[model samples]
Target chain A: SAVISQKPSRDICQRGTSLTIQCQVDSQVTMMFWYRQQPGQSLTLIATANQGSEATYESGFVIDKFPISRPNLTFSTLTVSNMSPEDSSIYLCSVERSINTGELFFGEGSRLTVL
Target chain B: DQQVKQNSPSLSVQEGRISILNCDYTNSMFDYFLWYKKYPAEGPTFLISISSIKDKNEDGRFTVFLNKSAKHLSLHIVPSQPGDSAVYFCAASKERDGNNRLAFGKGNQVVVIP
Candidate 1:
């Protein structure tokens, strides 16, 4: 099991502003992922962040709207650009301990509210 | 389309009884399934998982049963306690692609009472 943490557990921002959420893992991981959970809905994968590489984003999400930065193996950040009311959701970061186990550990999640 | 589905939004079980949470998937290509438990304002913690080759996997008091033919799976927690009350999520992944990416269902809120 991995100990994951996210900064800015809860934040309120005005429309047109951007919010960046950070994820830190206690140990190095192979793959890191970002997801969004709308209120009363299932989670949607936003992107896959690999160290020293550009993030691979899923459909309906782009780097322009959601820029990701992975400076090293144990840390990554996801920034919601030009935020709108619809951007309000709980953002979660997850990492796979190893390629063999196929299990994921998630951060506590960053809840963002846009006004 | 929702590849993974947890039909029940919430379940209530008495303390010391068995609590069963069910999940179904529409994708037959998915070969691995996992269950995660989450508390308020906390990240999901991995509970149990089953591979496509196996029908049942147990860990401690938690057991996961998988029925590939029916595309269904369930998580059972015996001797449920009040602290067991939390949201449970069911996730699936394909054996190929390294089984890293997962598709999750809408969670089911389980409330255990004394």
Candidate 2:
């Protein structure tokens, strides 16, 4: 298991503004994933961040809107640009422990609310 | 398409009883399945997992049963406690791609009453 932390545990932002959420892991991991959980909905993968490579965005998500940075294996950041009410959701960062089982360890999410 | 599905939105069980949470998936390609427990304002924590090769896996009071043929899996918590009350999520992933992307189901909120 890994200890993961996220900054801005909860935030209120104005529409059209941008907010960046930072994720830090205790141990270096190969693949890091970003997900969004809307109220009462299942999580949706936003992107996959790998060190020293471009972040892979999932369908319906674009890098222009949610730019991700993975400068190192232990750290990654997700920025929500030009925020809207729809962008208000819990953003989570996770890393897979084993490829064989696909078990994941997640960070306490950054909850964003756009006004 | 929703690859993973948890039909129950909420479940209430008495302490010391069995708490059964069911999940169904439409994708047969998934080889690994996991169950996660989440608390409000916190991230989900991995509870247990089962592989396609195994029918059941148990850890302490938690057990996971996988039925590959039916595309269904379930988590059984024996002697459920109030501390077990939380939202439980089921996730599935295929291992061939090495992508490790998990398809999650709508979580089930479990309330264990004393």
Candidate 3:
């Protein structure tokens, strides 16, 4: 199991502003992922953040809207750009312990509310 | 289309009894399934998982049963405790090119009364 932490557990932001959420892991992990969970809905994968390369965005998400930065193996950040009321949701970061096993550990999650 | 589905939105069970949570998937490509439990204001914690090759896996008070042909899986908790009350999520993934991505279903809220 991994100990993951996210900053700004809850926040309220004005529309058109951007919020950056940080994820820090206790140990180094190979793959890091970002997901969005709408209220009373299932989670949707936003992107896969690579340590030294650009993040891979999912089908419905684009980098322009959710820019990701992974400076190292134990840390990554996801920025919600140009926030709108519809963009309000809980953002979570997860990491796979090993490639052979598909177990994922997640952070506490950052809840963002746009006004 | 929702690849993973948890038909029941909520369930109530008495403490010290068995609690069962059900999930179904529409994608046959899913070769791995996992169950996660979450409390309000907290991230989900991994509970149990089963591979496509296995029909069942158990861990202490929790057991996961998988039926590949029916594309269904279930989580069972024995001697349920009030602390076990939380939202449970079912996730499925397909191994492709050495990489795996998960598809999650809407969670089911379980309330256990003592």
Ranking by DockQ: 1, 2, 3
Q: Model 3: per-residue lDDT, tens digit, A42-61?
A: 98889999898999988999
Candidate 1 lDDT tens digits, A1-115: 7899999899999999999999999998867999999888888889999998899998899999999999999999999999999999999999985574558888999999999
Off by over 4 Å in 2: none
Docking class of 3: medium
DockQ agreement of candidate 1 with the native complex: 0.70
DockQ of each: 0.70, 0.69, 0.64
Residue B83 lDDT in candidate 1: 94
Provide interface RMSD per model, one decimal.
1.4, 1.5, 1.8
The alpha-carbon deviation from the true structure for residue B90 of candidate 3, after best TM-score superposition, in angstroms, is: 0.2
lDDT of 3 by residue, B36-112 (tens): 89999899888999999999999999999999999999999998999999999999988762334789999999999
lDDT of each: 0.92, 0.93, 0.91
The runs of at least 3 residues in candidate 3 whose Cα sits more than 4 Å from the true structure, single-residue gaps closed, are: B97-100
lDDT of 3 at B92: 91
How would the candidate models be sorted by lDDT, starting from the highest?
2, 1, 3
